[model samples]
Target: MRVAFNVIDETIWFIDRPHEPWTVQAEARAAGRLDDERLRLAVRSALARHPMARARQAPWRFWQPGFAWEIMEEPQVDALSIVDCPDDAALARIRSDLYGHPVPLATSPPLRVRLAHHAAGDVVLLGVNHAASDGLGTLRLLASIVRGYAGAPDPVPDVDPLAVRDLRTPLALDGLPGRIRHAAALVTELRRPKARIAPERAGDGPGYGFHLVRLDAGDTPALGSRRPPGATVNDVLLAALHLAIAEWNAEHGAPCERIGVMMPVNLRPPERRNEVVGNFSSFVTVATDPEDRGRPETTVAAVTAQSRRVKAGGPPGALVDVLATPLPRPLLLKEVTWGLLPFVLERGLDTAVLSNLGRLGEPLSFGADAGDVAEVWFSPPARMPVGLALGAVTIGRWLHLSFRYRHPLFDPGAAARFATRYVGALDRLAA
Candidate 1:
């Protein structure tokens, strides 16, 4: 079976570089040990259930309209590994090294699952190429694996690959006038000024550097209680991020320009949720007044209004519109994308990104032996230009926050500092 790349997938594919790999990481911390062989077999079974994920890029020919994924019977290489991580330090080092390497596109599965067994418990890290799927899709894949490991039945559902890749939004543009309005909105967004964290001169090299923070389960409710009326937990977090960037930049002596955030809006309708396991998301660029940055309440209010407006306006159709545009071949699109990235970064790209997966709705279980997952953390790739990313998820009562930053954009120490500042910013909102 073969499936052509969708516009979003192609964008993720072409923008990928050796230094900046487009990927998503999801970590599950289980309370008990996992049998290596059982885990491997379970993952293999899950791969069979999700054939699209167990696929690699087909060799492209000059006459081909676009790149396609060649579905394989099994992973070309073993996708699971068992690492003996004795302590926190060892686990951190091993994880850093593992994440530095991109999941190979030419290899079947285009993903990796590693079990880092620490003295306390076992932590499983699942990394997937963004071109293959988004964070939510990765979660779905994880859920399938967990079910298989638990001796549960996970029957493969019949899915039409083409229909799943359809770029039409739920609130799609209706006609030529709607498209014209979309174009006008796009132009306005492009003209807006954006701010970014200044890249430091000192850094080890190019790779993803991240810091993890957990909002205490007891205090998680405060995230909701503190929000203004009609503002969701997501809206509050987005507001906190805007303030965090403004404050971080000011503390570092960077200019106080307009702060913009690119938020991924999940477009997977409930009806087709199980059928699609790829990038089914559009973006809405959120920004607020510079004056409101210092006032947490005001900032939250502003962000809340903006969020509501965009949600009411309709599901964004920018990516779908791009697909509608007549463009060049894959080679030319790659070149044009690369050439324009710098200009886009300075002018159009958001200052940072906040992807809130809300909560893992169902518990991830591995029968009794491996035990139920205690916690889950997800970190989206921090591609450059917009080098800073904040990925959040909820499992049980704890809220996991992953701060992923590019190497040159922020060293480990700086990344940690910024994360601390963000926590403090969130706390202020609660107060």
Candidate 2:
């Protein structure tokens, strides 16, 4: 059994190579001792339900009629691994695998799991191929694995636009007026200036590192409340990022123009927010204003205004969808060009991205054997050119702030300093 993937899937399949596989890294702690047997069984059951998990991609060639995933009866690659090491070492190992250990994309399941056993407890790390699923989709997959392991009911199948097109309602109007409006929005976004984050010529080389900081629950919500009325946590965070960039510029002495930020907006339908997996996200671009960001308050206000437009389905988000529309595109050449830039630029020297998973849809847990989820964090993939990315996750009261980056542009020392500045930016709100 096989099916053709959409263009977005095609793009990910190409961008992701063995050494630089586009994968999402996630960690969750179990409640008690986790049963390896149950975990293994759960994987098998979950794979049985989702054909994509046990599928293989056909080789890519210019002449290939079309790209497709051939479904298989059983998994073609290892699904899980168990390691004995300290918690810190395990986290390091997981971080390394994003660019070090390549996922067998052609034959293996699009995801892999590892359990690191330390004196304190186990940290469950999941590595999911971006071509197969995004971060939230992996969470859903993880939930299924846990439920299956704990002798609970299987996860409900996600909605498939292809499978139920006729029965399902259309997402938006495709009339001439609507199309014209979408096109206009795309043009406006294209005209918006982007930021130039200049690092020393030598600082933009290869190699990568991950740095993390935690904010207690009390302060996490404060990040949003302190912003102007109606501003969300996301708005405050973006404002904080702008301030961090300013500090970085001051520290580096690299005077540059605008610094554009591209955020991946969750586009999954409300019904599928929790259950559906796969790539249901689009990009929205917003640049920081020095005039407004001059002060922390003005910065938050400026960001809030721009972001509100985006949340209301403005140009930035519409731009991604216009280009990401599946093949047989209206304007093949144009869409294949500008429409594909976001995917390329995010990993290039154009803009930095911040993806906040907000909060886990359901409590992270298994049964009595494995404890409830104590903490959960994910790192957005960072590759060369575009050397830095910040991913955030909030569990109960604690907010986990992660800075994932590629080397030269930012060494461990640089990321550490940026982390300090990031937290400091948030602190400015209190002052």
Please give the distance, in angstroms, between residue 216's alpha carbon in candidate 2 and its true position after superposition. Answer: 1.3
The numbered model that scores best in lDDT is: 1
**Per-residue C-alpha lDDT of model 2 across residues 1-431, encoded as one tens digit per residue:** 76666545665665554544577767776666676766788888877776666767766654454467677889887688877766675666566654345566688587788876666666677777777666676766767776777777765655553343121113243544564566566555556555544453335333346787888857544464454466677877787788888778877786545666667766666777655556666566666656877787887777778887766653443543454443453334433554576654443233577888887666666777776777676766755545677888887777888787765566667778888888888777542
Off by over 4 Å in 2: 17-19, 157-193, 196-207, 224-227, 314-319, 324-349
Q: Residues 153-174, candidate 1: write the lDDT tens digits.
A: 6654466654567565453467
lDDT of 1 at 70: 87
RMSD of 2: 4.0
In angstroms, give how far residue 284 of model 2 lies from its true place. 1.1
**TM-score list, all predictions:** 0.93, 0.85
